[model samples]
Target chain A: MLSMVKECRRTKVFKPVLDHIPYAKFIGMGCEQFGDEYIFTLPSNDNNLGNPTLPAIHGGVLGGFLENSAIIHLLLKLDTPRLPKTIDFSIDYLRAGRHKDTFAICEITRQGRRAANVSMYAWQTKQSEPTAVARAHFLLEST
Target chain B: MKENNEALADFCQRGMADIKHSEVLGIETVSASNESITLKLPYSLNLVGDMETGALHGGAIFTLADQTSGFAVFSHLHPQIRIAPTLDLRIDHMRKSTKGMDLFCTARCYRYTDNIAFTRAVLYENDIDNPVAHAVGSFMFLETVKDQGWLK
Candidate 1:
């Protein structure tokens, strides 16, 4: 798993997109690619916490990760010449995300000419269940 | 009074720059009061650069709600006071926005007391009665933002 994560960091497909987002620099957003899916992980940061007594990952950060992963996957698969926009997204928090080592896995459902549909399930380390699931549609920019 | 509104708008633009998301969208307030603020989004700002196709992205909407709500409270604060961070936000999608149309946001400050403020926002393309989405959020005001290292 660590090797796969390292491979993603070196790959041309992932590096440029990661470079574009400076916040990712502070947050440490990285991914590990398997056969057809990718697992995105964010090392616990301070902004992710709620009341400090309980560590809950912020929903906005989670949503942004899912949205970015979906588009990045599309860019890698179809050789997208331009950036894709997320037209709609719906996230259901099945459970609270643990602040300890969080990660999300993405599954691309469909990639149309102008739109791509994708889903992601997020879980904490050593957990058997998913904490949150999101379905998002990305509108590809016409080349 | 209008000058105060303009100053508040300037303050919001400054606070929002901290997020970095607004740097790309270029959020500028047309008008604001203690109640609500109106935001304008252009066509090129579309994530897909084709708003006419109803391709408005959710991240854009989230950022807008975050800002409008932030301004909804910061507008009422003293000039030197720092803006608050969003504690949480809940958005329910109503319908897809019309493609190729500009987005106008009307965010309302429902409750602004001492430490926390509550806000609700409605996003529209051309229709007022029928909105594209509705969102509610809470912001936590702090006396000194630098002391709150947790936000970083």
Candidate 2:
């Protein structure tokens, strides 16, 4: 796993996958390598707001970021070049995501031959207090 | 009946205007009532998730469902509440959405308490029978028990 992470870091293999997702581009989502992990960032944008009264980020935008983060994380970890197809996604909105920079990290809880489960957490100001947490299952193509 | 329809139309317009993300997605209200609300999302090139297949992003579909569900809750509550923030949402993608086709979502507030509202919605292209995704969401009412008159 460490070697794969190092190789991906050296090659910057996740760029094309992230670049190809239009929604990610539309929302201005970006990813950065952090040691052995990657941290996904959703920059503050007025178009991403759900409730302007509270000035909170849209729940769906946060969901999208988390889902995309998981997919990118999978791409970095797994050897398959094909994009994973999401089967189902569940999210818990713990707090209102302020209209600001939000970050997310994904952890692969389990990986099987054909399916993988990833859990994601997103935070705005503090990493310890996540604004939202989500889990998703994806169908991976067999190599 | 005509008066109610006009009122619903006005409500839908005002609701969509307040949400920036809905506007970004080009969402429009098809029909709305206190019982249920239906919304439409026009297909856009920017919403494509996979360029090879030209499929609509799951995030876009999820956004449609989430906004529709919130509208369902709002329509159900009508004058009682101004906004209900999402507490949690779950979406199950049945299949990839067809390219160059608009999406529709119909949502209903199945249950509500003093503090929380529960809603379910389905997203489809043309036929509701063939849905692309199904979603269930819980929203916080953000109103006090006294204001909601739950004790009474």
Candidate 3:
């Protein structure tokens, strides 16, 4: 009972935080948050396609989506005034992101006072097989 | 085999056509060569990361650099290759770019074997020495072929 209430309160708090990111809105990414869990969706759009041959999503778009997911999760989890600045980003593309709606889930691997690290897994069809995985570190401001 | 002039023109048109991501970013071809490709990214309000400070989003620069690297690989080995999936990519941001200034990127294909190609790119606004970001990445070529025509 208490857990359900806690979930409702978290959604109310974090939903607005996600909307403030302009790139997320520009890219047409939508989010659903419950507690610390987040599901990020990237809608299939003409602008996101990189290869006109296979109609694959741009590698940058893939990288951006995962990166944004990490930032949002960290923001919501910490409940800070703004999102942390990115330190560095590394991405490994496991497969081609075909023209379709893509989804990503972020897991916080570690957290400290001044910095936080997060890992992201993105998949289009099969959750078991991720299209790309990324690790990003961010510098947090005073919380 | 296409002459140098014809190949350069072809690369510019086909590169803009083949990659929708570049078109969306308003990438303009500055120069092209068999070895490297250079392009420009104009500043856009849509790319701003912070409304308060008016800073351009890092992702926009990242997309530009990634596309430049892919195009560099394509310009060098055009007839023999079609697709190169990125195996890994890394970008290090040095400093925030000046708002409303165009970002210039140059990508060079350092080496490639049968299955993999390595690329490095630099993003700058006014000068190459003072860069906004640096990226080193690798891609997997779908098909590998040794073109004797390319050698000559």
- Best-first order by lDDT: 2, 3, 1
Task: Write model 1 residue lDDT over B41-112, tens digit each, in one string.
Answer: 664433432223545555556556656765676555545465466665666657665656777788877787
lDDT of 1 at B26: 60
Question: What DockQ does model 1 achieve?
Answer: 0.11
Q: Against the true structure, candidate 3 has what lDDT?
A: 0.78
Worst lDDT 10-window in candidate 2 chain B:
B143-152
Give me the displacement of residue B28 in model 1, in angstroms.
1.6
Please list all clashing residue pairs in model 3, or write none if there are none: none
Candidate 1 lDDT over A1-143, as tens digits, reads: 22333455457345545544443443456766666666677777665443332345545556566666666566556655565665666665565555767787777798787888888777885547877677877777676
Report iRMS values in order.
7.3, 3.8, 4.1
Runs of candidate 2 with Cα error greater than 4 angstroms are A1-8, A13-15, B1-4, B144-152
Q: Chain A TM-score per model, please list them.
A: 0.80, 0.90, 0.87
> lDDT per residue, candidate 3, A32-125, as tens digits?
7555467888989998898776768999988888888887777656655555777778899998899999999998788888888889999999
Model 2 C-alpha lDDT versus the unseen true structure: 0.85
Docking level for model 2: medium
Candidate 2, residues B1-152, lDDT tens digits: the string is 41235566567777677789988889999888888888999999899888777888888888898889987887766665545789999999999999899999999899988788899999999999999999999998766332422111
- In terms of lDDT, the best-performing candidate is 2
Highest-scoring model, DockQ: 2
The clash count of every prediction, one per candidate, is 4, 0, 0
DockQ of each: 0.11, 0.57, 0.48
Each prediction's whole-model lDDT (CA):
0.62, 0.85, 0.78
lDDT (0-100) at residue A127 of candidate 2?
A: 99
Instruction: Order the numbered candidates by DockQ, best leading.
Output: 2, 3, 1
